[model samples]
Target: MSGIEELDEDRLGALAHKLDRPLVLIGLMGTGKSTIGRRIAGMLGLDFVDADDEIVHASQRSISEIFDEFGEDYFREGERRVIARLMTENKGVIATGGGAFVNDETRALILKQGIAIWLDCDIDTLVERTSRRNTRPLLKQGGPREILTRLKEERSGAYSRAQVHVVTGDLPHHETAMQVLEALEKWL
Candidate 1:
């Protein structure tokens, strides 16, 4: 599949069957990991699991609530456990929390159990994309730019460790999803 025209459900399902393994997306917040992961899952006829959503489900509270109540270290631990659970499951697309890959233990867990795709995005695009969303606890602590810098400083290396990397600069959501699908085509 080379373009939008080739990304019909049949072709996508075939690609999913070809990979037959969980595909994990690693990237900063608002880089479209969750959005693209869901698209990929839909195209492939597979389930979609967002690491943050899983953590929320497991904790019975939102991520900000977790951090506000228990703290980031506590939230990170919860993220680690939730990611570990999702990585070991059947074929699906798992969109990891931005910080999940930064943890050595969680990074190792994902690398061992699944293929990691770094959803690359420029800082400008990220700021624009994330600005519309208010649910991000980290960015709320300070200026969005400063928070992004801190996150990039800390998590860039782990994102680099991914088996595949896709640069997603200002692309449409479906196009971004198709790019991820095309990247996995070779490995599949």
Candidate 2:
């Protein structure tokens, strides 16, 4: 659980020095993208912006509310707009929604502007992590394993397309963040 445990420190440090802007965190619901993105941004002394949060701000409604009132399609379109705006801003860490990467336009937009890090985690771990929260609309039914299975099948390919993939099931948030930075350091 040590900070940045999955990555070689020397390589990440070197990459951190050369970075021109904040990195982007992309992955499934419970992969710790928001938690770890904030930590990584703090470590690098950069701002952190969660695209979902931005979406909420612009719409003046929570994600759950959006899903409840406007349905998934509207929420998703709003997400695309929020992500597009976030990408255009100055350097700042960004954490995208789970569904955002699945959209062709959103995926292409992220790939073009930022270093996308996929916080890969096993289905069990994702289910466990997400179980503690109620903000997820897709997960409100049936069982966790079933939901995970569907999500994995639907988004695995898009997630795999990330510039850097960091496994995070057994690691703490700090360690995961470090690993992401480390892998990205060498990658960039």
Candidate 3:
């Protein structure tokens, strides 16, 4: 078996038993929070939720449509409410929108209700990953690298407040998920 398979088989039970609270992943848009969060949740035998998806469901609108129709402030307020509700109702891995942790209220709620994990990735990795998609609203205003750099500067402090910090790179999603599990194990 491969190293990853061995890791997963060996660690799954221990990791699943260690989860006492929700795992909230915070990071930039292309940092693989959703992907890694799903992997982690699967390993831990828990459900995975994307906060953005929850917001879209609650609002009955696409995120882009919400931003276009109601403006960023309105969308952010809605996001905060959705995240808060999800935390109270669900217990599993939650991948938050890139800007969700930047909101102080949302951040506070995450801190109180879950163990936040920051998926730290370098700017080049973020740019390359994000370049694959054009649906990102913030990237429409500037180059992917530039926008990610600016966001990294603005949001790194907030992300640093997370209970666990796992640096991600151009690795397989499961590998990154393993890194998050390692960090969470240490934190727990």
Candidate 3 at 88: error in angstroms? 1.1
Whole-model lDDT values for every prediction: 0.86, 0.82, 0.88
- Model 3 worst lDDT window (10 residues): 1-10
Instruction: Using TM-score, give the best candidate's number.
Output: 3
Q: Once superposed on the true structure, which residue ranges of model 2 sit more than 4 Å away at CA?
A: 1-14
**TM-score, prediction 2:** 0.90
RMSD of each: 1.9, 2.6, 2.2
- Give lDDT tens digits, candidate 3, residues 60-147: 9988888888889999999999899889877899999999999999999999999999999999999889989887888888777888
Give the TM-scores of the predictions, in the order they appear: 0.91, 0.90, 0.93
Which one is best on lDDT? 3
The predicted structure with the larger lDDT, 1 or 2, is 1
Question: What tens digits encode model 2's per-residue C-alpha lDDT throughout 30-53?
Answer: 989899989888777678999988
Q: What value of lDDT does candidate 3 attain over all alpha carbons?
A: 0.88
Kindly report which residue pairs in candidate 3 clash with one another: none
